[model samples]
Target: MQKPYLEISHVNKTFQRGSMLTDVLRDISLTVQKGEYISLIGHSGCGKSTLLNIVAGLTPVTSGAVTLENSHVERPGPDRAVVFQNHSLLPWLTVYENVKLAVDKVWARESASVRKDRIMRALEMVQIAHAMDKRPGEISGGMKQRVGIARALSMEPKILLLDEPFGALDALTRAHLQDQVMQIHHALKNTVIMITHDVDEAVLLSDRVVMLTNGPAATIGEILKVDLPFPRRRLELVTQPSYIKAREAVLKFLYERNKFVEAA
Candidate 1:
């Protein structure tokens, strides 16, 4: 078998709170293949976001290791780009500038024209080329998230990490952006790992859904393979029997895990 594109081996994370140590993640292990779309879902505070941060090297792991293509991950690099829950765009800069910042940072040695071309291409890919001149404050939440997606993709990362990237948007807007994201993934075929609480969203986008148990120290509760074919249609697929079955499996895992945590 080919080596996994991204691997997390027996990872754990703990935080210090005053005089006490709070364990957040415990013995988490997962392997994601190239071009795979994986979603992590669980109750609030289940360390799903923490795990994404660990993958991005935005947060340090207390134990174990995260590896990409056989090398250990110790710091952030252009090879892995993250889209945060909040669209972390610069309000002072135009949407084009916001994306340009990332492209320039990662490819600073390239000529100016090359950098500009790359940024514009990413914006076009996200269908936000029309909003290139607008600031984040001037765009809708969904549009800002698109800018975030554009910035991340502009880096041409090996893996894309998204932490609840549409969690803050309204229902219709979130649905629309979810479709846009799925379309982008289909076209680009980049490896993607997203942390989301939306079961329907997970079913519509992922190749597999991994659930984490509730945490003071969270761990993987279950992994459900999504048998639905892609390029997936959000509305049509959501109503299919396979999609319903997959969503149920994920929901049951999260519900049962939360109950287990509550009783402990």
Candidate 2:
């Protein structure tokens, strides 16, 4: 078997709040294979985003380690690109420029024409080629998010990290963007890790869903396999019995886990 592309080993994180040390993640370990799509799901404050930041090397782990291709994660690099929940695009830059910024930064040594071609290709991959010249302020929320995704993909990272990329959109818009994101992933076959609270979205998008325990020290509670065939469609997936069952399992886990955390 091929080696896992990313590995999180006995990871822990703690924060200093005034005089007290609060643990946010505890003994969390996972391995992600190449070209796999995994979703991390939990309630708010469950440290899902924290864990993604850790994997992305945007934040450090207090203990243990995160390794990509056998190299320990110490700092953020072009090898791992992130798409944040907030659609962190520069307001002054047009859609094409926003993506070009990332490509240029990562591929600075490449010829200017090569970087331009890469940027345009990434925008086209996300189906945002038509909006290439539009500024972020002029675009819809979904379009802005697509620009964010395009920017990330332009970097051609080994692993793509998404921190609740669709969390802020309306339900219909979120669903539509999910399809677009899934299609992009399918075509690229890049390893992806997404943090989300939406169980249905997780089931529809991931090869596996890793449900985290509630925080002040969150850990992996369960890793549920999504056996549904790929090239999934939202409406078709919703109507399928296995998809429904998998979603219910994740929801039940969250509901029960959160209740236990509350009572403690």
Candidate 3:
């Protein structure tokens, strides 16, 4: 059998504040194939982002481990790039500059021309090259998110980690960006691990939707395979029985099985 491309081996995470200990994740194990698109879906506090963070090496695990391409993931490296919901751009820099900052960090030793190409290519990949001269504050929210994605793509990371990257956008813009991302995935065929609360988005984008049970001990509750062939279109999927099946599976897990209630 082939070795897994990305492996999360029985991982666990905990938080310590004063004398209190909270377990956020327990015995969470997953394996992702290279170039596959995956979405982590669960209700709030279910540790979806926490698990993504562990794979990104942004947070340390309490036990078990993560490995990429058979290599231990001990820290954040160029091979793993992250794009968060906030867009996290430097307000002081142009869109081009924001992406350039990341290219410079990962390819500092490369020739100036090579680094410049990477920045341009990445910005072009997200169709935001025209706004390369604009500052984050000067661009619309959707454009800012585009720049954030471009910055992540600049590193040519083995896996792109997205933490609710479109959660802040309006519905129209969200749908538009989702289309572009689908194009990007088809073009790049790069591995993506995204955290999203939107079931439609997951069913539309993912090869598999991994659902987690409710926290503070969130573990994989179910994995739904999206059998619909891709180059997927949103409107077309709406009436697809396969798409409907996948969407209902996710909804059932999130609403009926793992329904969330507020803490008093």
Candidate 4:
């Protein structure tokens, strides 16, 4: 069997909050093929975001391991790029500078022209080139988020991690950004793992949807393969049985089976 490009092996994470130890994730293992899109969906406390953070090397696992392309992931590096739920832009910087900062760091050895090209391409990819001169405060929420994505992409990481990126947006804005993300993934084929609570968003974007059981110690409960064909249209999918079936499977797992667990 071909080895997966990204591997999470028997991972567990625990935190010492005050006097007590809290188990956040337990024995979580997953394999992601290159260029595939995977979505993690569960109730609020399921540790889905925690798992994504571990993969991004933003957080360390307490036990077990995570690897990408056979290299062990120990800390945050250019190989993995993350876009958090909040835009997290440096308020003092313009969109161009925000993305340029990443490109400069990753391609430090390269010439200035090459770095400029990388920044421009990333901004264009997210359709934010027009707002390149605008600071974070000057743009709308959706546009700021797009700049965040562009900054992440400017690094040309092997995998992209999105942590509920559109969660704060209105329904219409969320839907539009979801479509933008799908198109970007379709074009770039970057391996992705996203944490989301939206069932429709998961089904519409992922090649596979990974469902997690509730927390204190969350683990993978079910994995649903989205068998629908690509170049997927939102209008057409609403009426497609395969799409509906996939969407319902995720909803069932979230609502009927694995209910939310209150935090400790």
Candidate 5:
């Protein structure tokens, strides 16, 4: 049998504040094939983002390991790129400059023309090429997010990590960005592990939805396979039985498991 492309082996994570020790994730193990799209979904307080951070090498695992291509992941590198809900673009830089900054660092050995091509390629991939010269403050929220994703993509990272990347957007912009992401995944086939609370987005964008149990020591509660085909259209899937079934399954799991959620 072939080994997993990326492996998270019996991992655990904890935090220390003062004299208190809080267990966040326990015995969490997952195997992801190359070029797979996986989503982590759960209510607030779950360790979904923590797990993503571990894979990104932003934090140390209390125990166990995460490896990519059989090499241990110990620190943040060009191999893993992350995009969060905030976009985190630099206020002083224009859109083109924002992405160019990453390309310059990752492909610094390359000549100036090569670097420019890298920056333009990523901007075009996210359909933000025309806005390259615009500053983040001059653009809308959705455009800023496009720049953020382009910046991450410009590095040509092996794994893309997203933490509620679309949570702050309006419904229309969010849907549009989701489509852009799906198109990019189809074209690039980059391995992705995204943190999301949206059930519909999970089912639509993921090959598998990895749901976590309620926290302080959250673990995988269930993994639902989305048996739908690629090039999924949002409007067309509204009445799709398989799509409906998958959506309902995720909703069922989320509803039954998140009982601590108090009704507002």
Candidate 6:
């Protein structure tokens, strides 16, 4: 049998502070196929971001393992790129420069022309090429977020990790960016794992939505497969039976079983 593209086996995470050991994730195991879009949905304390961090190799897993292409993931590398809720663009850099920084770091051995192409390609992918010369402070929140995504994609990472990338935006802006991200994923076929609390967003964007139980030691509660076809339309999905079923499944998991608590 062929091995999974990304294998997360029996993973657990814990934190130590002032002699106190707090268990975060417990024996979580997941298999991600190539080009799949996975969403992690759960209550505030359920460690969705923590799991994403572990997968990104930004945080250590206390036990078990995460492997990509049969190789163990032990540290942060170019293979996995992350986009956070807050755009992490450098204050001194323009949108172009922000993406260029990542390309330079990851593809340092390439020629200057190659790096520039990489930067421009990513900016254009996110539809931020028009604002490439603008600084983050000079743009709207949505544009800044697009730059953050462009920087992450410029590295040509094998997997994209998004942690609430649109959470800070207004409803309309959030919807627009969600469409952009979905379209990008459809085109690039990049493997993605996003952390989101929105049931509608999860069903809208994911191939499978993995729900987490309430924490101090959270584990996967359910995995709802969204069998909807590609190029999903948000307005049409509202009345579509398949979309509504998936959304209700997530809602039932989040509220009826998991009892979601909003983080302060």
Candidate number that wins on TM-score, 2 or 6: 6
Candidate 1 lDDT by residue in tens digits, 1-264: 988989999999999989999999999999999999999988888798889989998899999999998888989888999999899988999999999999989999999999999999999988899999998989998889989999999999999999999999999989888888888888889999998888888888999999898888999988999998787887687579988888888877866647734310
lDDT of each: 0.90, 0.91, 0.92, 0.91, 0.93, 0.92
C-alpha RMSD of candidate 4: 2.0
Model 1: lowest-lDDT 10 consecutive positions: 255-264
Instruction: Give lDDT tens digits, candidate 5, residues 82-173.
Output: 99889999999999999999999999999999999999999999999999989999999889889999999999999999998898899999
Candidate 4 least-lDDT 10 residues: 255-264
Cα deviation of 251, candidate 4, in Å:
0.9
Tens digit of per-residue lDDT, candidate 4, span 108-204: 9999999999999999988999999999999999999999999998988899999989988888878888888899998889999998888888899
Off by over 4 Å in 1: 260-264
Candidate 5 lowest-lDDT run of ten: 255-264
Clashing pairs in 5: none
Least accurate 10 contiguous residues by lDDT in model 3: 255-264
How many residue pairs clash in model 1? Answer: 0
The runs of at least 3 residues in candidate 4 whose Cα sits more than 4 Å from the true structure, single-residue gaps closed, are: 260-264
> Which ranges in model 3 have alpha carbons more than 4 Å from their true place?
260-264
TM-score of each: 0.96, 0.96, 0.97, 0.96, 0.97, 0.97
Best by lDDT: 5
**Ten consecutive residues with minimal summed lDDT in candidate 2?**
255-264
**Reference-based TM-score, model 5:** 0.97
Instruction: Sum up the clashes in candidate 5.
Output: 0
Candidate 2 per-residue lDDT over residues 1-264, each given as its tens digit: 888889999999998889999899999999999999999988788798889999989899999999999999999999999999999999999999999889989999999999999998998888899999999999999999999999999999999999999989999999898998899888889999998888888999999999998787889999999999889988787789999899989988988757743311
